[model samples]
Target: GQQVMQIPQYQHVQEGEDFTTYCNSSTTLSNIQWYKQRPGGHPVFLIQLVKSGEVKKQKRLTFQFGEAKKNSSLHITATQTTDVGTYFCAGSTGGFKTIFGAGTRLFVKA
Candidate 1:
């Protein structure tokens, strides 16, 4: 069985600050995806990393996959009210099933 886990389940930041969340998997993953879910909203796809040690960025957000393909991370450069959400990392083992980490809840203060 495959499993994905995330740490620091919750984070709080002030405006202009930074935040980060980490995810780990029990088995090597073929690919990993990140998602963001706003309060009272559904999860929205952010990015996907397939290559080992790959890193990608979008505006103030950065995503990374570990060299072993069993870990990943998401970092937000500056905090904002709009950035408040729960972040999730999902890992797939080259199959239809994907294991999702226990989302990290982020709260930003203005």
Candidate 2:
């Protein structure tokens, strides 16, 4: 069976600080997707990396894919109160049944 795991089940950061979360899978992943869910909000797609050693960035956020395709990471340069949410990683083996990781919950303090 395929499984996706994440680190730091919970994190608390002060405004203007930095935060990082990691994700790993037990099997080779065909593709991986990152999502973020705000407090009392639904999960929204952030980005997806399918190629090995790929790096993508969006403003203050960055995403990296492991060269082996079994791990990934998300980093936020400067934390903000609006950044409070849960980050999740999902893996797909080329079809349905994508496995979602247990998400890293973040709490940003004012």
Candidate 3:
């Protein structure tokens, strides 16, 4: 069975600071989907990375895939209060079944 693991379970950052979360899978991942879930809200798709060594960015957020295709990371530049949420990484093996990580909850102090 394939499994995805996310690091730091939780993170607390001051507004204007930087934040990052890591993800790793037991098997090579065909694609990784990132999502953000706010308090009492559903998870919203953030972005997806497919190619090994791929990097994508949205505003102050950056996503990266490892060359080994088994790891990923998300970094946010100058964290803001709006960034407070639980970030999840979902690893898919050729679009069959996607395994979601435990997610890293981020708390931003304004």
Best by lDDT: 3
Candidate 1: residue 59 lDDT (0-100): 97
Write model 2 residue lDDT over 41-99, tens digit each, in one string: 99999999999999999999999999999999999998989889999999997898889
What's the best-to-worst order under TM-score? 3, 1, 2
Task: Estimate the TM-score of every prediction.
Answer: 0.98, 0.97, 0.98
Worst 10 residues of 3 by lDDT: 90-99
lDDT of 1 by residue, 1-110 (tens): 78899987999899899999999999999999999999899999999999999999999999999999999999999888999999999999998998889999998999
**Candidate 3 structure quality by residue, lDDT tens digits, 1-110:** 88899999999999999999999999999999999999999999999999999999999999999999999999999999999999999999896788999999999999
**lDDT of every predicted structure (CA atoms):** 0.94, 0.94, 0.97
C-alpha-based local distance difference test score of model 3: 0.97
Candidate 3 backbone collisions, by pair: none
RMSD of each: 0.6, 0.7, 0.6
